[model samples]
Target: MNLLRAAATVSSYTLLSRVTGLIRDVLIARAFGAGSITDAFWVAFRIPNLLRRLFAEGAFAQAFVPILGETKSTRTTEEARVLLDRVASLLTFVLIGVTLVGIIAAPLVVSAMGSGLRGADRASDFDAAVWMTRVMFPYITCMSLVAFASGVLNTWRHFAVPAITPVLLNLSMIAASIFLAPRLETPIYALAIGVVIGGVAQLAVQFAALARLGLKPRISFRLKTAWADPTVKRIMRQMLPATVGVSVAQLSLLINTNIATWLAPGSVTWLSFADRLMEFPTALLGAALSTVLLPSLSQAHAAGRKEDYSALLDWGLRLTLLLGLPAGLGLALMSEGLVSTLFHYGAFNAADVAQTRMAVIAYAVGLLGLLAVKILAPGFYARQDIRTPVKIALAVLVATQCLNLIFVPYLHHAGLALSIGLGACINALALLTGLRRRGVYVPSKGWGTFFMKLLVALAVMGTALAGANTFIDWLAMQQHAWLRVGLLLAMVSGAGVVYFGVLFTLGFRPNQFKKGGTPLV
Candidate 1:
């Protein structure tokens, strides 16, 4: 597959999902506002969401995809099918058990996640969160299966299906918030119901695609058969360390959620809104690039093509810088305006916008690092070397909590965002250092010149954005949604024009961006 083409396919679909997700969030903010109800919903939603990432997208995908790709490339078709079935059987059994337990232990989980809710004043929100948690628990089981199917398709180079599956999630939530919430006595339960529906829908779409690819998994409970499979054992081995590496990052976020619970009523909601905005660029670029790169990297490693593996990593990093820097800086610069324009209306007041913007800027400060983790972690995972990343993630987690202790006292919820960014930067740096120390990756030539050009381009874009910012009254944006959106679009377009124009003027060409899957000299 053409790496650039595949990334674009994934990015385009992901962009659509984020756009709809933004709409869903906008409705949510209008209906619920940034308070106890919204906070409860976010916390409840996060329990299943975080577990889905930990089990499905993060460690599970990392472990499954490499092995799946290798099996497809190096083994017989019958053998690969058997491996897939056995893995599916084991995952299905485990996830079902986890889902049942998670539902049963919702109160304990909620209490552990947000102990601040234990206060008498917050008991209502605590009970609400626990109920919502049970409602959303089954989502983990559905998405775990979806993730496995996604791995199968990604190994088969069916990028569009998995990329597009997230749209169902955004649509389900949007429909729930707008259409279902108002009808319900407790509106937030609609969102939880939508979560379960979306998970099932996501799983169904991927399952259909897998059937079309003739890779439909045969489900079973033959533990002896599964344990007898060497490939399954290898995946389990990789999953152990990969889980720690993945979970530490996610656990840090849970820690932030825990910390946010004690701050103020709107703290959880504010951080969540800012995080949604960050996910826009992150899903479009970071996730899309990582999704496409992992299988390719795995393919290279499986074939013992050391040089190709290095070049793919080099190519991914260069692309990371090319896109990530401008995105992070622009987001930090435009946080206030962007938040107000997109989200400030109805129950989401100016104060909410202000708080969310601060978090946005804080999170954007480490946007590059966040994006880098997506690209870099795959480098380690593709090689089935999970210990290095787990150690690095653990160290970063510790330092981040330390920063959290220091910054939260001063920065409030925004400090949590900042610490997350700091942890991401540390994580990315450690991954890079490990890659270099192992001599598995070497930077390509012209990196210095490339970065210099990037700096110049970024400066030009910043200047353009600053000039555009002068004409808009941010306070007035809350009253005129269309006007705000129009102005934001124009400013973003002009900034992009200036940034890319400068790069073009400095001898960068479209062809340069398209040149991937080539060995670096």
Candidate 2:
């Protein structure tokens, strides 16, 4: 696989999804605003969403792809089909059982995630959280199946459908928010319904694609036999560490949510909104690079092309820094403007924008670290070394909890943002250090020069944003919000132009960093 081409394709589709998600969040803010209801809804929704990320997206994908890629390479088509069928059967059974347990335990889960919602007056709020969670819990089951199918399709070199699946998920939510949200007695209920519907639709779309690939999965009680399969064991071996790593990450979020609940009414909503904004760059660039590079790296490693693996890893890291750094800087500089323009309408007031902006800026500080993990973690997974990440992730989680405790008291919701960001940086550093120790991350000759140029470009970008923010402030004094928004956007575009244009002029061609068969280091 051409890593760049795959990254481009996945990034394009993911960008579309992120854009739609932003729109959805904007609409959600307008309908629900930042309040007790929104907090309850977010807490409820986060439970399943967190599980989806931990189980399906993180652990499952990390494990499934490399094994599936190997299976496709060595096994006959018929043999691969049987392997997939057995794995799917077992996965479906496990996911269904987990979802049933989650539904049955919804109340306890809500209570754990939202300790603030106890007592006589807030009992109704706690009930809302439970109800919404039950409604949304089925999403975890559907999404897990979808993730498994996605792994299969990706291994088959069919990325478009899997990449596009999230777009359908976002669109489904957008439609429900637009039409169904207002009709419901509580808009949060509508959003909960949308979550479940989107997951089902996401799964259905991938199922259609699987059918086209002649790999339609069926639910079966075949676990007794399937669990004994060698390929399944290999997958499990890879999955175990990843499951722990992802669970640690999820637990960090759960901790943040639990803590945020104890803060002011809008704290959870503010954190969620800021998280969505930060995720745009993450989902677009970081996720795209990881998704595209993993399969390629796996194939390279399987082929014993250590040099190719190293070069690909270096190139991915450079690309991540190149894109993520400026995006983070821009978000940090324009956090207030972004929050004001995107959400400061209807029930979302100036205070809400201020709080969300703080969270957004704090999140921006950690953006590079998060992006680094997205790029770097794949190096271990692709090499079939998942255990190290789990170890590193555990350290990161402990660090995050410590930071959360230290900062949240002083900064409120924004402290949670800072803690998560710092933890991500620590995680990325640990992963990279481990890779170096393992001899999986040999430094490339161009890394020094590439990083030098990137830092220069980023410095220039920051200078431009500072100048533009000053100009925006001057314009804002005119008291025209629309003009301020337009000017701020223009300023951001101008910064991008200067940054990339200067980089190109300084001999920083994007293609120069592309990995060939040989390792540059």
Candidate 3:
């Protein structure tokens, strides 16, 4: 089908998830605020989240999707079905073990990620974190399975299910914050309970979607039989380097989390809230486009359609700049307003908004690069080439820590965000260069003009935001919550209109992005 439409569909669903997620965080901030307890919960949640990304979404999807696409194209229907069952069997077997280990070693895991939690004054926070970690540890099992189903469904061109299922988790958290947190002796435990419930809900929905397509795996417990399958072995082998690549990113997160723990009491929570805001554009544009592109790119490779392959990458990059730049400019210029509008409420106060705004601005600096990496890395993943990106990621990881040393001393937690953003830009550049040198991706014509037009649009958007920032007192308007929300929405929407209105005048058409043939599944 039309790739742009697929991306738009995924983006639309993702926006719903993001909206619900923001509400979840808003409820959280109102109830709990950015404090030691919230930091504890965020850190504890990171453990299972780390495992899910490492084993399923990050490494596993990168490795599994390409091979599954290849299998669907080259093998019979029965062969593909068998491949799915065996892969599922092997994955479930592995993640179960990881989950158990995580539960039993919850204390060590929490300490490793956030050592500062162990101080005598923070002993309660440390214990609470461990308790939550154990409760949420099993979340990875359900989420990993969900990720498997998502990759399978996306490969089958069922993008809406995977994109929207995340909303279940957000809703689960929101419900717990409202209904469960108040009744509990330890309210934070409600979030952990919510995490498990959400994971299971998401897993259930994903599997149901798979069943609708009759593509659900017939999971087997026979590890030997699954391992003996050549396709399963290939996925595991591909995961080797893919895991390393993903690990580099996770490692940075682990380091940053630990650093945040040591910086200030609310640093982790502030950064987390800021991160949720940044994810709006990221999930909408970067993730949506990449999800649609990866399968199509794999199809192009399988069919030996070189021109189609390059054009798809070009189209994704153009869309990245066209939309992502305006988003970044809005975030950086009006960060205080955005943060205050969304988060300044009951428990969350002016100081928290100020701190969160700093991180948002830092993150916005690298939004384009972050979006670019999402688009470019899939270029290698679709070709079943994970090593180049892994090597580049290792270097970026090193550069990030070095930048952290230089910036954190001055900028505090925001420095951690700044370093990560800068590192992502470096990583994207290196990936683009590698793709060019290897002749895997060639830049299409009009790139120069494309960027020039995007720059002009971004300048206009930035100017509008600067004007809003000066005239609007976001922190002072906290008492007028609804009015602040209305004003923020109007300013962002008006600026977005000015941005895209310029692009339209400069001749950027939706038709240019309407490339890619019917998806091959």
**lDDT of each residue in 1-521, candidate 1, tens digit only:** 67888889999988888888899998888877899988999999999989999999989998899988898899898899899889999999999999999989999999878888889999999999999999999999999999999888888888999998889998998888889988998988999999899999999899989888778999987978998888899999989988998899888988999989999899999999999999987889899988888889898998899888888888889988998999998998888888988888889998999999999999999899999999998999898888888999999999999999999999999999999998899889999999999988988789999999999999989887877778878867676788888888887888888999999999988667675536421
**What TM value does model 1 have?**
0.98
Local distance difference test values of all predictions, in order: 0.90, 0.85, 0.92
Which one wins on lDDT? 3
Error of 3 at 42 (Å): 0.5
Range of the 10 consecutive residues with the lowest summed lDDT in candidate 1:
512-521
**Candidate 1 residue-pair clash tally:** 0
lDDT tens string, model 3, 1-521?
88888999999999999999999999999989999999999999998998788888899999999999999989998898899899998888788899889889999999999998989999999999999999998899999899899888988899999999999999999999889999999998999999999999999999999898888999887889999988888998999999999999999999999999998899999999999999999999999999999998998999998878888888888889888888888898889889999999999999999999999999999999999999999999999999999999999999999999999999999999999999999999999999899888888887899899988988888887787678878888878989998998899889979988998999987777776322322
TM-score of each candidate? 0.98, 0.96, 0.98
Worst ten-residue run, lDDT, model 3?
Answer: 512-521
- Minimal lDDT window, size 10, model 2: 470-479
Deviation in angstroms for 295 in model 1? 0.8
Which ranking of candidates, highest lDDT first?
3, 1, 2
Candidate 2 residue 327 Cα shift, in angstroms, is 1.0
